[model samples]
Target: MTQPQGALLVGSIAFDDAERTMRTAATELGGLLRRIPDGEVGPRFHWIMFQPDVLGQAEGIERVGEERIPLRMLDARPLRVADGVDPREIRFPELGYARAARESYALFRRLREEGVIAPGMRFQVSLPTPLAVVGAFFPPEQRAAIEPAYREAMSREVEEILAAVPHEDLAVQWDLAVEFQIIEELPGGVAAWWDGAWAGVVERAAWGVDLVPHDVEVGLHLCYGDVAEKHFVEPRDAGNLVRFANAIADAARRVPAWVHLPVPIERDDDAFFSPLADLRLPEETELYLGLVHREDGAEGAQRRIAAAQRVVPRFGVATECGIGRAPAGTTEGILRTHAEVAAPW
Candidate 1:
């Protein structure tokens, strides 16, 4: 079960909530995670995990800040569930959430200092993207203003996280579910907004990147909704590829970091990657392809791995999205299957 050289696998524990509790994440995917590479024993691996202490609840508008703080004093607005306010805007006390991030950073620092990771391991820390914060509250029309707000907030968050982790040992991944926020909107508005926001993030990162120590890994995990209902976030249509391509290309060119993406889940469209491969990205930027489907069985997984090998050689293996919604046992099978399929390649 030891990982072979250049063995590609999914990143670490993905949780269902923003708080990123480890036990919660472990319970959600531990069985399978424990089984992979003979229960976490194998291969030069890539892991994705959340810093729990840094998180607030995804519930009521104000999930940020210390749990001890009263919501009313913290800018948290009260509303009836039926009142129709968007769920994310309920802000918690800014100071509390900010402190929480600091405390969480300590925990991550401690774990690293204690050598929680094995030798030769590279890990990626994931946080909610700036767009995620704003989109969670605003409607399509209001989303335009979120970019500026998120940029300032996110830039600070990124800077703090980079300071906390060892620059050389780990990588950072900004989870961008918000980029797909306007999937249901007219393509023109959605595309324009995302393009602008993507640019803003890159600009913010210019300073944020320097905060990380030299040689620290930085990446962007771009996926549409991983939830069961929302399925694919962007249009899978022929014309839709152009916009997506632009977004990916722009992010790559601007950020110059690894870009991990989910495979197109709705159809068997290998061609969807045609635009991606052609993107003007650095040769050093790695592409982690989500080759194994959460719902795929042994046969389906084999097909997926084989198909992907045809396009990219240095590609890594991962799930289409986090397995938070799936039963832990099912997710375990996926991890194991990914190892099996990639063993020969």
Candidate 2:
């Protein structure tokens, strides 16, 4: 079997705080990681679930429902443009990403200086694309009108993060979950307001890649929705992922340093990984397969790794998505699974 190279943490981790997350990751998976994140703790524990509240804070935006959605911890109601208020005129407050990154980087820097983290590891800051936030929080009619404003806000957030953190030690990853919802045309998924779904998605991705300077590393995290540990729809194969990745490689001004694709746990077969044979990422770009599932431990990851190696001879390993929402007591085992299945960098 072809042994996997390194490991990638897809942003969030379930640790109590950024310090613990960094400490634990360094202790267990340090040699295999090129970057580390702040565990997406607090409001970000549920990925973009808390974004509605942030958007609701803007003057012209208000939550559609009075109460939090049932069975969910965060206020995930859709927002609307207030009467007589134009969506394009709304101004968003600090969306919290840059602030969180600034705070986390302080801890990251301290840890590295104190020798808890390796000197070479970059701090990973993952941000959802504007389409993701706008699509998830606003109605279909409001999306197009509000997207530009939100995109501008997000661009500012990126600028803030870049300005605060040293480019040499920072790596930005654009999370592309909702784009898949549109592409798959899943029931109740966000529909693309732009002309062509594929072109629209790729354009947004390229725009995000352009936000970061060439000196800094940027990556793409292509995902299916990971609500309650389930994908909104299981991919038929790696076809869509391969096609989208190739388009981004060609479209972006700078090719992403890495691109990650999720692997459902049940798909440890050649059919699921076969489409990878056509992937056209440049030699400088890295590929990470999210095949590690704590439920099955390292043994199951090996099975998937073996299948993937049949087509793509070299790659990295990661969980299908962030582990911030993972059940208590599972994080450590998951971290260990990555270490056990992949070779050190």
Q: Who wins the TM-score comparison?
A: 2
Q: Which parts of model 2 are misplaced by more than 4 Å?
A: 70-73
Residue 200 Cα positional deviation in candidate 2, in Å, after optimal superposition? 0.4
Cα displacement (angstroms), candidate 2, residue 253, comes to 0.4
Candidate 1's residue-wise lDDT over 1-345, tens digit each? 222112233333333322243333233333222111111111101111121112233233233344443322232321121245453453322312234334544544444365542333444455555445544533455456434544555566566655655555456655555455444353433343445554554443343333444576666555665545244455453233334434554544244355556665444456555544444446766556665676665466556555555554455556665554455556456546655544332
Question: lDDT (CA) for every model shown?
Answer: 0.45, 0.92
Task: Assess candidate 2 and give its TM-score to the true structure.
Answer: 0.98
For candidate 2, the clash count comes to 0
Model 2: per-residue Cα lDDT over 298-337, one tens digit each: 8999999989988999999999999988889999999999
Model 1 TM-score, 2 decimals: 0.61
Deviation in Å, model 1, residue 232 alpha carbon: 4.3
Model 1 bad stretches (over 4 Å): 1-116, 139-147, 183-214, 229-257, 343-345
Candidate 1, position 196, lDDT: 58
